[model samples]
Target: MSETATVFNQQLAARSAGGSTDAPPPVRHVCVVGGGTAGWMTALMLATTAYGPRLKVTVLESPQVGIIGVGEGSTPWLRGFFDGLGIEESEWMPACNATYKSGITFEGWSTKPGFQRYFHPFASMLDNMTMHQFVDNVHARLEGADVHAHPDRFFVAAALARQGRGPRARPNFPFDIWYGYHFDATLLGQFLAAKALERGVQHLQRHVTQVQLNEQGDIAHLQLDGGEPLAADFFVDCTGFASLLIGKALQTPFVSYAENLFNDAAIAMPTPLGGPIESQTVSTALRHGWAWKIPLSNRHGNGYVYSSAHCSADEAETELRRHLGLLDADVPARHLKMRVGRMENQWSRNCVAVGLSQGFIEPLEATALLFVQRTAAALVEALEQGDLGPAAQQRFNDSMRTRFENTRDYIVAHYKTNSRTDTDYWRANAENMRLSESLQGVLMTWLSRKPLAAGLKAGRFGGGYPIVSWYALLAGMGIFPDPRELQPPTSHQARHRLDAVDDFVARSATNFPDHRELLAAIPPRVGDKTLQLYLW
Candidate 1:
């Protein structure tokens, strides 16, 4: 056996000496490599402890290594994550130039002649009987209704976004909200880093040039670009695609999901909008790829993700510019070359790979940032139980893999079920495409509008969003699971609910604040400059 492997096993044995029945030793030092959102998030969460002094966290990030700054959309789970960290939105909003993102607008996917779009709104009305009744009314329209009509009219965010409004915490609401945000990813990394450092986590400014394995096959230490080595009992790999520790040193094989997901490259550009900023993200499909328009308080984050095998980067850039005609000159265009896959093991030996180090599933639904937050949360939870012993490490690995697969399945579902044949990219979906077992089953049951089977195990991380979110996207894409089985509301109920919704939507538009106006509410910071990072 390799000397490194031997060392790894020995360390595992020492850590697991207490046996499966006893609580494992506390993690004394955690070395996190990479300082992007993933790295800082891991450090911040891991440094905080119910055990208090049981954990000590350190982050190594290159002052020069730029991060891929493209993801601007997120799910509502972010609010909970921030709350868990005891972070006030106002503390970081100005520094990040953030804006509220209620949901995504999927445009140009239908069998009809002209492209049709639908809003996959954030909050569902299933909680309120009146809203549920309204949804029942809309369900009728969904049954045999005018398919070209905007089904999103029934959604709160879609309606409020149309009026360019943001969300405010309403005490009278049935549920708080279903909202996320659009911000500069690089800025967010810096914001998290500052917070992490303030909370007693050590930050090292250096690039990892080499990862050394000890005699037992575990990561023993990593050498910096031009400095001494840093070692720790546990390591969290957030080094983006380099996967220096997990993939290179630990030699964990990667499981590709390329066949199921088509788009491989993305071209991103940021454009500053001076007018009233919109508080919604719009994802429109093109002939060969898809384009995302994420609105921020100060600017719009736009990108085109395409299959590089089908089209060149130059062509994609031109296409993106054509779509965004009024783009500013200062908004330089950049390209992100990526793969859609996950590592065979996210947590292997004494190391765990998070963010792009583990793998990337493209930036379709903005799962990248949220994935980091969730992974950090899971790691924190596991560490709180004790150190990353074999059992805990295995559980962590399983959970990360499950989350990646779930995200991959959902992204693949979007492309595989697309009925549009406008271009070669769209036609790719028509081919006999492979699907994960979970996605395959979802596709099958979608034909009947049946809910997911009870006792569904989320495996690793909780599935992003829920099956219902998929149902909305599928229905909007014209991939009716069971059109005949769809229920419609009664006549009187339908009319009454529609009228109430119309009134509610109208009132919401009038009352809601504009995106830029909300940002202006923030107290101005002296010498606040926007941070930019380049990801090649």
Candidate 2:
């Protein structure tokens, strides 16, 4: 293994070890409200990460509230999250009905011929050569040169998905490939709650009736529905959209993203796993918005995310049913309202907002849990540094604001450059002038055929998406010159393709196993007491 990867692996394996004991932490007791994936994730991270020994973590789960059993998609950061917690894939995958996800395949977003669908794959070691060529072709096509620029041909992840392959490489394979997962979110939350309990985190079940604040306008305590008041030195609000602590108690201002992102609601319906499992999510464009088909090990998760301003609940469900070919199927669909925005301050005096309390940018890119992990990790770093004052809080707030805006810009870009004008929803998105300066720069750079790397700086613009993602997304949507006004490529590889990218990706894919066989071998871990499920 390479020295960097070796060191990274070691650090990730040792991530749960407590911090130095030389100095005392500011807060000794921490209480996390709510108990779904967000709450348990926060509680587990606090109970295991730095200052863990010095901290007393308590999770207050409401007995009256039930968990939303919606399936979820993820980015590769989730791998690091489980790794940091010292949890193995075998322990959680089967327990959560999980499936490996290489990337997302977008379908019917464009009206242009041969551009109706494209695959956006995760970057891997094999893309070192093909990605440069893909970028060159994108630039060449920008100047009206005929070239193959579809990203699916350049990355190995798409090939893996196409061949129904999982991401786990053989022991002899020297390189690591990044991957995500599609799983039952509620089951994962239950598993995480058990893991947190194993690590000395207290779990209490009660309904929070009200959030009480101190004289200084900070959260003082929480009053339970039928129990005594509970107080803690610090608070974490994971109360989904209710925002019990940070929103109600502290009254932090909210910053809306309605202008940038228009989707305000969603309808989720899970159907039985119909056939052999594929390792990619399929996102198809609909009239009002987009629909997602995420394949899990046990079933298929289908949903439509649309704007209520242009479409109603029934209208969205009907469109989704038509898309899924289940117009009259006996499947029940659950409707949900989305608050598409972020809080002005994620952290306010002695309390931090995590998960939905922090804010939501929608589920387009599956960044909901990612931001939750980010907030928890940032809290860990701040507490490890022993800085809990106003200055530290402002720094945390400012940093998170930039991250949210950057991620929002990426999602907004997906809507802005869309070629679909079939409905008023898409037409308005195309004509929408509300854009961040950074987004404007990215679009201008693509238009001018400048190196996208120049526009997307390393850290500032690439919140979770790298420069290659911007290239893939823009090029995937057919945001380039028409093929008719094109010339043959003078590039050497395009002429005489000795050792082609396709061959390389195909060869690399051999190192991985079949998706179905791999998942089938994982004996169900849901019944295992080590990671017990929460019986509601």
Candidate topping TM-score: 2
Query: What is the Cα-based lDDT of residue 230 in candidate 1?
Result: 90
lDDT per residue as tens, model 1, 47-97: 664433456788988777888766777776676566555577788877897
Residue-wise C-alpha lDDT for candidate 2, range 193-230, written one tens digit per residue:
88989989999988888888889887788898876899
**What count of clashes does model 1 give?**
14
Q: Name the runs in model 2 displaced over 4 angstroms.
A: 1-20, 458-464, 491-499, 522-536
Clashing pairs in 2: none
| TM-score: model 2 vs. ground truth | 0.92
Clashes of each: 14, 0
lDDT value for model 2: 0.81
- Residue 32 error for model 2, in Å? 0.1
Model 1 C-alpha lDDT versus the unseen true structure: 0.69
